[model samples]
Target chain A: MRRLPLYLMLSIAALMVLFPLLVMLSTSLKPLDEINHGSLFALPQDPTLAAWTKAWGGACISGTCRGLSVWFANSFAIVLPALFCSLALGALTGYALSLRTARWVDMLFAALLIGLFIPPQVTLYPMIVLVREMGLFGTLGGLVFAHTVWGLAFVTLLFRNFFLSVPRDLLKAARIDGAGFLATFWHVMLPLSLPVCAVALVLQFTYIWNDFILGLTFAGPGQQPVTVALNVLAGSQFGQQEYNVNMAATMIAALPTILVYLLSGRLFVRGIAAGAVKG
Target chain B: MQRVHLQGIAKSFGATKVLEQIDLTIEPGEFLVLLGPSGCGKSTLLNIVAGLEQPTGGRIHFGDRDVTDLEPDQRDIAMVFQSYALYPTMSVRRNMGFALKMQGLSTAEIAAKVADVAKLLQIEHLLDRKPAQLSGGQQQRVAIGRALVREPQVFLLDEPLSNLDAKLRADMRVELKRLHERGRRTTLYVTHDQVEAMTFASRIVVMDKGRVQQCDRPEVVYAKPANRFVAGFVGAPTMNFLEGELALLSDGPALRLKENLLPLPGLWASRGLQVGQKVVLGLRPEHIGLAAADDVGTCPGHVVMTEPTGPDLYVRIRLAGQEVTSRMSPGQAPSPGQKVALELDGKAASLFDVADGQRLN
Candidate 1:
């Protein structure tokens, strides 16, 4: 009886967190006419898969009728390579900073941390020029490059801090076992870094997949990710805003990040627990 | 397999020196133990020998080859750390074979060598287990097995048993001595436990405050400690010291206390002895005992406390305004506050110069 208020408070907090997702899901299932007639809290009166199907393949974006599928593939193309590059670079950089005895790493990491607080807008013009100089200004490669640089600081910080807590004696033992620089990282450090790797993957995937500004700036006309495509599909230029289709599109775009969290949620929690106390 | 030599090894972290001018050699198959309290630089010296830490100034030679600049693997040595330091993600088989694999050994040869070491260590049942799955003692055996599989020139152990409980540590200490006997590998071990140093070391190096106070056999170190620090550091229940001045007695050179005179060793020379020279009288606990009434050269003391540890009793006696402990057999246990006369074995007693704390002949 005494725990009633505590449980009530927790349930209310969870509802608050789940309320927006619930609205998006209900609206996505409802047709446009029913959505307009029914209140936001009401259950979908006549649910149909048509809006989801149209949002996936038949929705008009700007002038084109091609739906979010192409942009979904583009998202993967940009995110996969960018995720690979950033995560790989981040893990190695973090390992070197935490385990190796390079005198310059601490300063280098400090300078990189300044990048995290800088709004992406502040460096957009310089990055655009740099990408153009490399002749990849509006290419997918350019977008991947930008995302790699954008995520490097955060993932590197995560990995470096996590690896810092690993026992130094393990590294020494590896060295005495004849494993050198890269070998020690691969055999000893990397194998022991599975939990942190899940954290890095989920983090980088969500950031790169959901990014719109960088995609709009650098992904060119046809190469834009689903986020930018979702904007074009639901923007003012598309005449009337198809509210149901728009909600369905947003739901489709959010599915991957949600799926990633579900798959690695256990690991994410464990990693946070393991990584927090060490810091 | 190789005799190791260290010449004038010194180490400093920035401006603070941790070790200085250390010169020692480990004969092939010799078990040399560096024994000291924490912060005594014994572990640092072991690291220097293992090539894990470079010296500020020194030359290390393995057999006839100079290995001062070589990496640990290049120097062909193995180390067991205090934490055991088993690779957590690998199984026992993989861990023991890691160094051999690094040497590019064939699968068959690595397997054979691992099997041999596994059987020797009696850890064959644990071959499939990860380090975390085994008990502390099993992990330690696997750690030793990993060192053995490599067949390195020298084995370096840095307080490897300090992390274990008392009982397990004693068991592993016997196991380590047995392994050394079977393998005959030149090993340098570092520990703060006097019993470990005394039982396992062919030669023990007693260090204090980054300096080697004495390097000799365990019996020699215990019987004749080079300085006051060693005398105090190397024994359990510790040696007792009574401040006094060296003076010429009518019979011979003697140590003059506040109210009594204790005779020095009969073979003692008056060469370094002087009248009224300040000195410290050192007596091992076992060399003092309860005296009979009217026994000459016996000083009267009153018992303050007695501690019994099955085989013997340590009786603390108040004498000359100071507390002195004497180890007596259970049969001779005296009750607290009882008056007794204690006899000092003059022939085996040591005297130290008060100013320098160096033992005086």
Candidate 2:
């Protein structure tokens, strides 16, 4: 067919994008001696689950021999509560702001927009002092609080713009139907915002899951997330690096975000498009 | 049913006055429609009555209970929107029952009320379907059913049928009229469509530039519009306006157009018509008809165009240096360039003072 060349180019582009993952998979499956002696692109003649198992549970990470499992649990602990708290607060704030036409609401929204543009590093010192003042510094709660605070600006912006597109008459109708503010939001606005929530969820999940500096600074050693643990495992100074274990560990740390995207990719695209077009 | 009274309802946004000094009352079980062109502030007035928007100056009362500062939920009102505004995520049953449920009604009571409304609106089979699954007309009925389930003291609708197709709109109009007849609820409807206002309103409030021009029975508003604006706005193919001055003809007082003197009917003679008084002639298309061979008070003209709508023909005539339309039966429709005489009924025609646009004899 006439489209053969276009298909060929697309296949080549896909291969180029997937090549690094393929190499990581090949390197992770090979034995240590084979990896040292053979080509990087070579398939493993005798594959093993040694590196995966070691990276998951047995390898030393920052003088802790219990590998990424504890830290994986720590990441989930930080992410789940942070995600729930931030999304709940963000959606409510967005809905409330969308209903009012006062000048103060717009000024407050502008302030939130200003909050969104500042890099996390710029606020890390102040946040530390604040958290320390609250006696939450270096605790798992501190990390969750940090992530939730940083996530609110973006999540609120997303939901606020989405909520603004809803028909004003719908709100009036709800009011005339004898539904109060919270009742209308709970029954009407929340259900209508499912797509926007998905977009926020996936994005917040990725940001919180992959975070490094925040986890390193705010979390206690025992509560450090997998990103910090992965860094420690990969950069250990005493011994020769185990490339296979590091690669496998990197793969494990990145798995949840990948799966989150894969499961809800269509909805994510739709949500983004809906927000963009409507806003 | 409760009487609705809106006293001195005035609203202004910054420097722009949207409504000014609007005072009206609706008797129990009256269907009063606020009709106007776009930006006439009809919708704003309706919002103020429903307690959705606060007026800068007003007090609203429902049967002697002042509700001006009350939130919409406390006003015991229900409204149907132009877009229907149905809860898209809920089934029709839940959408209808939501308001009752909000009042802390038991499930049995809510379901009973919802079922009764659904049956009344003939949307029982659509109870389980989401709003998105239904067609436009069905969603509209569901929206109405949602309002009906509340059985509130006041029903407010803002152009509820404007979004439907012509046929569906006509059907829904009849259905809404029937529903009102059964419930006898005090209702306020806002729309820009003259036909909808004429057909559905027991009384039509004609508004322009944020002011009420005339509020009267539909038939009275149609036959004798209070001012030039009402006369021109309330009719289809819009009323034709020609500037002239009152002059004396051989038989009677007449309106003098460029070289043409239109003889006035005998009824205007006793109204103390003065000679050489300037006025604008407001003539409805239907009032200008094909003249009989020996008809008196006829203005001669030539047809410029003929528009054949299904049942009637609207002929645009070039008369006395002005273009005017004459509605005629299809069988007697004139071709372009055909010479004709149009009978202008001086008795039915509206004469407006050129200065204030107010009606004159």
Candidate 3:
């Protein structure tokens, strides 16, 4: 008898959290007329694949009907490069900061940690000017570099904490066995860092793929990621409001990060626990 | 064979000096144990030898080469940490072979060497198992195997057996000694376990407060400790100390305790004794015995406690307001709260200057 209220409360809370996603899905499948006339909670009266097809290949914007597919490819090109570079550099920097006990390195790490609190907006103009001066502004490469820099602080911090948990004696033993810095890191340290790398990859991939601000500012029209393209498709003034198509496009833009979280959710949780817990 | 020499070694953390002017030589193919309680810098000294730590001001020599600036790998040393720092991800075999593989040795050579060492250590069957999968003793063996496969010039072990159960530790002690006997590698071992030092070390370097208290053979350090610290540290149950003054008795110089005047052995009295000078008398528990009242050299006391250990007993007795233990055969036990007479073995007794804690010759 006591479980009924708790069960009802839990269901209500879960529905509240999932309401927006469900609305998006339902509206995407509804026919244009039904979507225009009915409440968000109502089931689609004339469910059809028309909206999905239009979002995938026929959504029009400023007389252009190339759907979100072009933006999806663009987002991938930017995100993949940014994610790879940031995670790689973050892991290397973390390994050095955690393992090396030099005074300068410690000071440098302290400064980097302080970088985590800096507001991204404070440096936007200078970064834009710098990117333009480097001939990378208005290109996918410029957007990737921006994302990589923004993602580095969290990735480095995560990797550093994870590396600190590793027993120092293992590294010491490897050193005594004739392993130089890179060899020890490659054979001993990197293999032990899989859990942290998984976490960093997930975090950076999600952040870069979903990023709208940097992508909107730096990415050229041909290189704009899916988030910016979705905004353009949804809020444009020239066409009749295609609610179904806009919902479908938003769902498509969110799919990769959602899929990543779904696939590796267990690992993500475990990695966070392992990296956060003190020995 | 490889000889290690540490010269003028000093280490300081900020303003605090941890190790100061430490100098010691470990002869080739010798087992030298650095024995000290925790925070005494025994492990720090071992790390210095292994090149894992850089000395603030010093030079380390492996035979003719000055390796003070060399990396740990270039110095050719292998250490077994107290925690047995085995690679958690790798199998026991791979952990052992990792160093050899890092050295760019051929796979065939690495395999053969690993096989030989594994057979000797009796861990051949555990090659496929990870460190977490193995029991404490197995993990310990794998750690030692990892060190063994390297065939480095020096083996630095920092309290390697400290993490095992008592029975396993005792068993591993014998195994480690046998391993040393077989390989005869130049080894520097560190531990707080005095028994491990007494049993394994060809020479024991007793340390206190980051200074070398005494470095001598096990028997010599046990029988004639350099000072009060060495005397108290090297023995189990430790040596009993009684504050007293040297005085002249009818026979010779004697030690005057609170209510007892224990005569010093004549041989010690002849060396030098200033009248009324403060001194401390040292006696091991085993040297004190329970004697009959009528026996000569007997001092009467009341039994405070009795601890029985199968074949032997430790009887604590109060004499002159101080408690002293006497080891006796179990058949001749003294019960608590009973009157007893204590016999002192003067030949094994030692005297120290009260101010300096230095042993009096």
Candidate 4:
């Protein structure tokens, strides 16, 4: 009796938090006519898989109807390289900065941390000009480079904090064993950093995979990532909005990141807890 | 065998100096201990010698080769850190063999060396265990074994037994001495514990505030410390100090405490001394004794406290408003608040100039 109100309040909070996702799923399954009525709480009058298939294989964009498979491939191509390059660079930078104490390195890390709070929109026009100068605009490579730069701060900061938690004695021991910088990092530091690396991978994967702005700006029509492709599908100008197809396309664009989180959730939590305790 | 020489070593971080103009030579097969209080730069000096740290200004030599600018690994030295610093991810066998493997030694040689070291350290059964799986003492032995397999020119240990419990630390101290005896390697060990220094070091370098206060054999440093700092720093329960004036007696000179006078030996009195000169008298607790109330060479005091540790008793007596401790045999333990007479062993006493804390001959 004493805990009844607390339990009821918690349940209500849980339902409130889940309400938007439930509505999205319910509306996604609804028929076009029911969706047109705009009563989001109402279930579909007739259940069908047609909307999901249309969204997965036959969404229209700019008078062209095609499945999102091409855009999914585009997202993968852009994200995988971006994630690898960013995490690799971040880990190396973190290892160097943590082990080598120098005024210049400290200044460089300070600059990188300050870069974290800089608004992406402020760099938009200049980055575009720079990308054009490098002959990378409108290419998948350009999109990867841009995402890598954008994701570097978070990854480097995470890896740096985690690496700092490692005992300095271990690093000293490796140094005394005749390990130079690269050898120490490859053999000792890197092996000990798996938990943090997993975390960096998950974070960079989700961010780059779901990114809309950089993907939209730099990725030309031939190389547009799935998020941009889905936007074109849902926001098409000259057709009756294909409600089922748009819902299915949104789900498709969201699925990879969702799957990553579900699969690596335990490691992610452990990494964060481990990093946080040391900090 | 190798001899290490550090000449005019000085190190500073920004404007703060940590070690200044340090000079020492470690002979081949000598077990040298750098003993000091924490933050006295003993470990820093050890690191400098090991090439883990480059001195701001200095030259270091190992058997005629200059290594001041060399990296730690290039210096042919192995160190056991206070934390043990065992590779947590590797098995004990791999941890011991890592240095040799890194040097591109053949697997057969690495295996043999690791096996020999492990057997010597009594850790052969733990070869398959990770550091996390082993107990503290076991981990410490593995760390030493790792250093031993390298067979470097020198071995540096920075407070290696500090993390162990009291009993384990004592036990490991004996083991470390035995290990040093067996290997006969030129070793430089850093520790803040004086007991470790006195028990294990062939030569002890007592440091304070980035400077070597005194360096000598353990017994010599214990018996005749260079100054008040060494005298106070090198003993357990510490040497008791009393400030007083030196006065010329009819036969010799004596130290005059308020309400009590302590006669000095003829040898110390032979040195020139003014009648009213301020001085400090130093006495080890064990050298002071309890005497009968009317004993000729005794001064009266009231017992302030009594601590008995099975075989011996520590009696604290209040005299002239100052507390002095005396170590007595357990058979002579005194009760708190009891009146007693304090007898000084004049020949074993030390005298220092009050102002500068320098010894008087």
> Residue A274's C-alpha lDDT in candidate 4?
79
Q: Which candidate is the best by lDDT?
A: 2
Q: Rank by DockQ, descending?
A: 1, 2, 3, 4
List CA RMSD, all candidates: 1.7, 1.7, 2.0, 2.5
With a 3 Å backbone cut-off (N, CA, C), the pairs that clash in candidate 3 are none
Per-prediction interface RMSD in Å: 0.6, 1.0, 1.1, 0.8
Q: TM-score of chain A for each candidate?
A: 0.95, 0.95, 0.93, 0.93
lDDT (10s digit) by residue, model 3, range B1-361: 7999989899988888889889999999999999999999998899888888889988999999999999888888888989999988889988999989988999999999999999999999999999999999999999999998988889989999999999999999999999899889999999999999999999999988889999999999999899999999888777989889877776555678866787654426435768788888888989888766566655677899999988778888887689987788898887899987677777788888899999985
Give the better candidate number (2 or 3) by DockQ.
2
The full ranking of all candidates by TM-score, starting with the best, is 1, 2, 3, 4
Error of 4 at A70 (Å): 2.0
Query: In model 3, how large is the Cα lDDT of residue B65?
Result: 97
User: What tens digits encode model 2's per-residue C-alpha lDDT throughout A1-279?
Assistant: 999999999999999999999999989988889988889999999999999999999999777788789899999999999999999999999998888678899889889979888999999999999999999998988888999899998888988899898998788878887788799899999999888988999999999999999999999978989999999888888788898999899999999999998898888888888872254
Error of 4 at A35 (Å): 4.0
Worst 10 residues of 2 chain B by lDDT: B264-273
Docking class of 3: medium
Off by over 4 Å in 1: A100-103, A276-279, B248-253, B263-271, B292-295
Q: Please provide TM-scores, in order, for all candidate models, with all chains considered together.
A: 0.97, 0.97, 0.96, 0.93
Two-way lDDT contest, 2 vs 4, winner: 2
**TM-score for candidate 1, residues paired by index:** 0.97
* Better DockQ candidate (2, 4): 2
Instruction: Return the top candidate by DockQ.
Output: 1
- Which runs of model 4 end up more than 4 angstroms from their true locations? A1-3, A33-39, A62-66, A276-279, B247-253, B264-277, B292-295
C-alpha lDDT of candidate 4 relative to the true structure? 0.86
What does candidate 2's lDDT look like per residue over B1-361, in tens digits? 9999989989999999999999899989999999999999999999999888999998999998999999987889899999999988899999999888888999999999998888888899999999999999999999999998989899999999999999999999998998899899999999999888988788999998889999999999988889988998888889999899988877766789868887756527435657888888888898788889887777788999999998989999988889998899999988999999877777787888898998886
